[model samples]
Target: MAILPICIYGQPVLHTLAEVVTEFDKELHRLIADMHETTVAAPGVGLAAPQIGIGKRIFVWNYADQDEAPAIGVAINPELWIIPPEPGQADPEHEAEGCLSFPGERFELRRSAAAKLRAQDADGKWFEISATGWFARIMQHEYDHLNGYIYVDRLTGYAHNEAMRIKRKRNWGKPGLSWTPGIDSLEG
Candidate 1:
């Protein structure tokens, strides 16, 4: 498997809605393998197909720090629903999230405390999974990518302003992008 070049914040693909994965074949398998390798190399908790310049609904997530963390592999054509917090419950945690597409950047954002996911495997097998805490947050972030949104899109108020400031400084908010894998960004 090869590490694909991550399409940065300026890439149009990251903003465009991804197409559904219809055909499961050798090419799809290779892409999934490459994505997993790239995720590990980037040392990221998750990644989506659009980040690699492919406008397809797929993502991989691995909470590698945990001893029993399960590999997310390729979640194709995934659908997600955020679980609402209980009544009288405190607000969900707001935490800083980093993206490989936006190297050296992190934005504090709030998301649901839990989520349920429905997706197909690389071989087109359907499955459902539930996540909470950090894993839930990561899945939400990656799901946004499938719907043509980056994590920055979720920022608000001061966080939004700060993110925009960084984007402007790094020249990362433009529309076109191209990069060589591993050579483009030290972290990516």
Candidate 2:
């Protein structure tokens, strides 16, 4: 396993739809292993294939901060169904999150309280899960990555404006940018 460089926001691959995983072989396994390593190094709860500049529908999550977290594993070509979020002002303390792509930035965005996920493993085995609380939040975040969206892209109101200001100030949201976890001072 190796730590892969994480692509930043505005990388073409992050904006482009990822291809479905058809052949579950050595390459897929290696990529998943690499992603796991990179996620751990980045110290992120999850990492998606596009974050590493790989345009494949795959992501790995390691969520251990909460009770009954999902097992750390790879989710490929996953489909997500969410319970609608209640309408209200976002609670930054409770709802704020970050992204590896938008390194060093955090924003408050409302998310579904619960979600149902159907996905496959690296070896092409199907699995289904119901995630709640922070695990569900992590799932929604990673799922958005597979669909060519960073967390900032989902922000609105003051949070959205703040994120955009930061993007402009940092000169991010452009192509040809990447960072290595455990090596770069940047954090997300």
In order, candidate lDDTs are 0.81, 0.89
> Going through the candidates in order, what is the number of backbone clashes in each?
0, 1
lDDT of 2 by residue, 1-188 (tens): 89999998889999888999999999889999899989988889899999999998999998876554456878999999997898997787999899999988888889999998899998999998888898999999999998889989988877889889888887788999899998877733
TM-score of each: 0.88, 0.95
So what's the TM-score on candidate 1?
0.88
Collision pairs in model 1: none
What residue runs in model 1 are displaced by over 4 Å at the alpha carbon?
65-69, 84-94, 178-181, 186-188
Cα lDDT of model 1 overall? 0.81
Q: Candidate 1: worst 10 consecutive residues by lDDT? A: 85-94
Shift of residue 131 alpha carbon in model 2, Å: 0.3
* Positional deviation of residue 8's Cα in model 2 after best superposition, in angstroms: 0.9
